[model samples]
Target chain A: MEGLQTVGSALLTLGLVAVAVVLSLYERLDLEREIGVAVVRSFVQLAAIGYVINFIFGLENLGAVALLLGGMVLFAAWTSARRAGDVPRAFAVAAVAVGVAAVATLGLLLALRVVPATARYLIPLGGMVIGNSMNAASLTLTRIRDDLAEQRPKVEAALALGATSRQAVAPILRVSLQSALIPLIDATKTTGIIFLPGAMVGMIIAGADPLEAVRLQIVVLYMLLGSVSIAAILVGTLSYRSFFTPRHQLRKGVSG
Target chain B: MASLKIEVRGLGYGVCGTEILNGVDARVPDGEITAVVGPSGAGKSTLLRAINRLIEPSSGEVYLEGVPTGSLDPLELRRRVGMVFQIPALFGTSVEEAVLYGARLSGGDADPGRLLEVVGLDPSLAGRDPQTLSVGQQQRVSIARALALEPEALLLDEPTSALDEAARRKIEELVRDLNDRLGLTMVFVSHDLSQVERVADRLVLLADGKSVGEWERGDFFSEAGERARRFIAGRL
Candidate 1:
């Protein structure tokens, strides 16, 4: 019984997914097939990513790391831009935000010698920061666009009273940024109590010392907080101008 | 009082394929109320907004004090020609903050209490949240917010359409007082011809995005063109 060898481990994972499918059928929930498909996709994608990361780690070259990180940022921006529907140059805007924040944060960490300047350390840390900041940028941009659309009267009222575009949308901008950061803030506040975050768990599973894992986890959390804050602010500030015209008129049809 | 404060020449605005204002031409005298009266979709609001550059005209020019609006910084222009929307759209949480919002943005010294007093509101109401105020009071706060800028001209878009009779009369009195005391040029969009006649020193009739006719307050009833007459008689 060797405690589930490789083949047995694979089947055990499949069996766990089967439980959800069975329960879904018993409860008449329509998500049985979706659950199955999601499980399979996650397994396949993670396996593919594992191999890619292994290859990337073996490269140990600065160019390869930079190219990979750039690709990740481009893809992240593309996904984030979907949330900012109808906003002009949304992809470019998100790319700039996520790219700048992730780079700046990682650069600072590397300069401080907190993270080594190698593919092994940089790739994972940059990926984590970029991915979280992407989400923040997407949420903030989408929220700001929607708020500007819904609150046209409020914005124009401010404009009519000689407020600049920046002044006109300031309140909504503040709210959007606050809303965008709320999820990260809450997760950070309840980190140990609610659940073990992914980075710490991954470190522990890799046989690192628990105390060392906790320290790395703290750095990851702080990095995410700083990077996401920058991302949200950049996205929010850059996107508001699109809501107005050259003559300072509020654009009524705020769409593609 | 007779100098031209706002001159709209061949102003046109179109959205997509539909024309909102088709070459509107009119002049607003300084220190006088110019009532723009038209039927629904006559581009009354568009014309007023165009004056303040809130809605850019597709082809035309708006001159404030004989200077083209295009040449000035829009923010600066907007400060000079303040506007009030149909609905009382206050920005900040409290009434005092709302009144001060514009003034602060324009880098002006805004005395909330004095602005409130000028708008006929009790100075104590400054501390209350604008959301808690009655619609009429909110509308007054809107006016005070605009006046805080100490603008040379004022644009009102159906300022009383949402209010009751008493509230409407109060706003009308406030408008007249502001005009007389400040000598501010005013362009007010209204559907109510009676109110226009009662408070406006001059009247401009717009229909189908064009200025059909204009007259002094005394002559509008007798000398309005045929189409404006139909609109006045509720027959258009």
Candidate 2:
């Protein structure tokens, strides 16, 4: 009955969508259809997930919760792997990176009782951690792969000088990691002053206390930072090996 | 007359079925400069890399000092057989750092000052930034870097193609001088027949990824070497 009332109230927010559509119509911004589609898709997706999450919260079994979270991590890994072009075995790299980061961060949160051991808290928070880690994993993989190609002469120069593949790429790994982490770093830096995060705002909209919302949002930010760092480091460490042979020679066709 | 310092035996390297070095063979005599000369796309550079195992050969083995290089640890092999590429690809920003890079990799040290002198650069240049120097000086720094490994043999892949003619002559002199003074086995690659004649004790003429003819410098320039004549005539 409460969920039904919330959905009824949310339907009144169509006027908010119409405001953007009206601006697009007047200025011919070419975004009216995209806005409409995004709103519809997000509404449908969130509404479906809401009912599913409601049902999971009722059952409250640990195994079932773990299975759902594992599915999210797998999809995140697969999506990130595809985003990284031309890297061989990137799927396994992404899976290990994103999966480990999520497990470590979420496991710690649950173990510390900072968040309750329930599907309601776990599913939404897991989405935030997995989604951010996935972005970091893909960004690091793609940047490292491309940077290796761009820095081929430097890398090959190091290799020819008898430096191991690890030593040769260690410099590049630093730069790629910085590239992956910069976005999360900036968002964390400006979180409260610039804008309230979506999770915090959602909590407030659901009638939770603002201070309580801030507490969860801070945890979300720190979790993101830690997970993104782990994912970036792991993806970089794993992907650089693909560029070299076991003899430490830069493999052919890796540049492309 | 000296024992062969490096022997490349029927080496073949291909990429995606396009053969880059096909059954190439060359013998680099000890303490002498052997120039691999070829036209563009002749796999001269590829042949040089095959010796260092920078580009692993598909069908053959390279022997260093009578030992099959494949049987040795590759990092140790590379340290002993250093290579200098065409672009003077210096790694670190500081000249001293670049010169000492190989040394550091082997957990050893070489005097960057002495190395700079060996490659015809002032020791003071070591303190300067390599990127700020002229291309010739930078190439010399790269050569110094290779020498810092204390390699038994040095492979130079067109070490002066990116330099002007004067710089090229200076590098040629430095290479010849290194051979004379250090007794380091020197194998250099170039398409310029004139450079090869000026620098090499012996020559390997490559065409279409194969060693078509190998000759002492005396025979290569003389009239009796008919295959050399054909290559010079662009008839091969």
Choose the strongest candidate by TM-score.
2
DockQ result, candidate 1 = 0.76
Which residue pairs in model 2 clash with each other? none
What is the C-alpha lDDT profile of model 2 across A21-105, one tens digit per residue? 9999999999999998999999998888778788888888878778888988899989998998678888899999998998999
Q: Which ten residues in a row have the lowest lDDT in candidate 1 chain A?
A: A1-10
* Candidate 1 residue A19 C-alpha distance from true site, Å: 5.0
TM-score to true structure, per model: 0.92, 0.93
Model 2, B1-236: lDDT tens per residue?
Answer: 79999998989999989999989989998998999888889998888888888878899889998899888888999999999988877767789998999899879999999888888888988778789999999999989999898899999988998999899899999999999899989888887777888999998888888888888999988877766767655832
How does candidate 2 score on lDDT?
Answer: 0.88
RMSD of 1: 2.7
In model 2, which runs have C-alpha deviations exceeding 4 angstroms?
A: A1-44, B230-236
Looking at candidate 2 chain B, the ten consecutive residues that score lowest on lDDT are: B227-236
lDDT of 1 by residue, B96-145 (tens): 89999888885667899999999999999989989999899999999999
